[model samples]
Target: MAATNFVRGSVLKCSFPYVDRPSRPGPHPHYCLFVDSFEIRDRIYYAVCYGTSRLDEPLLENHNGAIFSVDSSLIKGSPMSMRVTHFVCSHVAVIPDRWVYRNFQARLDFIRPEGRKGDRLRERMYDQFVLLEPLMEYEALIAVNYVRKTGRPGLPGETTLR
Candidate 1:
């Protein structure tokens, strides 16, 4: 089947589109995908971090290009839900550590609220990361409910959502 516009359970690879901001910006606005999943040893690996290392590469190897924002009002609601989970697999015994993967995972997890650290599928992951930017609609996929409930009414770096 062809990819759906808003896919549920299936992770999407998307990027930030360049917008004309009043101030002069970089040659191009940097882009990052919503998230991705990799399958190894019958288990799936999901990642949302930028790269192997801040030093290795700011961007990862398989990253697909950006997904520009679409107006939510343009489309009516549907029964389905598209989920985004961000987590790093903790090191397990017997296997040597994957330094790059673990490092970025720790960075993303650090953004999680103190009480809710550990595990990806848990609702706590939803709370801490999603509410980080209450008004950031596009990135809101990860924590729409947490934001609707407790978000302080503003987008990241902006004063108020309104």
Candidate 2:
């Protein structure tokens, strides 16, 4: 999917490279919700907040950031099969368009060499990465508003898109 197709509220299951662990074997695949997108010097960048099943009590209670929880039933056809997922609004990642495209192409290439089976695998991968269910507009608005209001620092420095 083209970066232009990614709008706010889109929930994508993509490989998020581990910034702290550069020596990790491969990209860490997970779900991320697109909260905002903008262009900088002709390059498109997306501001995304990560979704996790683990619930952090302290963070939810006293952290300056916001945490929005979504029941599994709210997410139609959830790939993660999580009973409850929380979006950490305070921790955001500004990802570049090229980073998204590069990882997508890499996944496709890895699955495309196996003939018919490869085709099926590629289709499933595409659905997860590009066509996954999206968060409701209201939910996205609340999350985005919290992030903005709290001025939570997003991922620092340039994200190393592996």
* Top of the candidates by lDDT: 2
lDDT by residue (tens digit), candidate 2, 1-162 = 125665444565644335574212126555666666655445555566666777766656643335555554434333455676676654556555544432321112222334225465444543443322243233334433443444432344332321
lDDT assessment of candidate 2: 0.47
lDDT: worst 10-residue window of model 2: 102-111
lDDT, candidate 1, 23-101, per-residue tens: 1122322212223233334433222221111221212221222211212121123211222222111100011012112
Q: Of the candidates shown, which would achieve the greatest TM-score relative to the real structure? A: 2
Clashes of each: 4, 0
Per-candidate RMSD, Å: 18.8, 11.5
Question: What TM-score does candidate 1 reach?
Answer: 0.21
